[model samples]
Target: MNIKDYLESGTLEAFVLGSASAAEADELQQLKVKHPEIGYALDAIEADLEMIAQHMAIMPPPGMLERIEDRIHELKRHPVAERLPDQLRDHGQRSEKDKGQYIEVEGASSHMRIHKIWRWIFAAVFILGKIFLGFAIYFYLENRQAREEVKELKREIRQHHTIIGQQ
Candidate 1:
């Protein structure tokens, strides 16, 4: 096999980009060990890809790393287990002081509360939709009537032509 042709076949690029098939990857690995030129070419392709990635990389916003580190520290200080209610941690057993401390949330109300402005907007939209529906129905009926009139006129014209031809 010609090493130059193999190198130029883009197999090295595919392998570096993780698009090479398992068989192709295995073959390339074996060849890399046997051929020093393949190894050098593979290394060169990887380095070029890395350099391109570094050049195209975007810098994170300021204080992003610090915020992430601070959040990690906060989580460490107050772990998730410590945040859980005593009832949950102690298998449904609650202390006397914790009994009436929390309100039992029941999904009793099905109505959703919306802002007054939104309610007015929704009403306006509903009224407009009904008006548009009325206009659409009226136009549809008018169009149907026009089509029927046109058909009748055509029939009359055909009758007049037949009568004239007979004369």
Candidate 2:
């Protein structure tokens, strides 16, 4: 195949973007091995894409790197089980309903795990909630006591008025 025509056909672009079909990728790899020019061209295109990306790069929000590092650390702390890749998944193992679709994989634990910081925060909140509940109950009892005293005072006033009228 003519090198110029192949380059202009956009196969290289498709390959770079990972949109190339398996057959096309095989052909590209073979061509790259046989011809030095194809290899050079692919490298050139990749560099160009990198340059374009650098020029178009936007600054991430502040502390994004810290958040990302925290997440990486979290993932490192609790290692998940290795999954069978999509291509390597056995079709025989899949049910008839799941043949065409992706299947969900179970993790090591069914329960959700949280960060240590969150556990502390949750404990603090729970303790504060209990304290507030205690305060509410105390205030309710005090109010009830005050209401009973007021009723007693009203009864004493009525009894005094009857005594004064009789005299």
| Top candidate (lDDT) | 1
Clashes of each: 0, 0
Each model's TM-score? 0.45, 0.46
Give the residue spans of candidate 2 off by over 4 A. Answer: 80-167
The lDDT of model 2 is 0.84
Candidate 1: misplaced stretches above 4 Å?
Answer: 74-167
Q: Write the per-residue lDDT of candidate 2 for residues 64-148, one digit (tens) a residue.
A: 8988987687577655433554434563565566667765555544456578799899999999999999999999999999999
Clashing pairs in 2: none
Q: Residues 3-120, candidate 1, lDDT per residue (tens digit)?
A: 8899999999999899999999999988988899998887898899899999999999998898799768667865877656568879888889788787444333453446769989
Q: Which lDDT value does model 2 have at 97? A: 63
| TM-score of model 2 (CA atoms) | 0.46
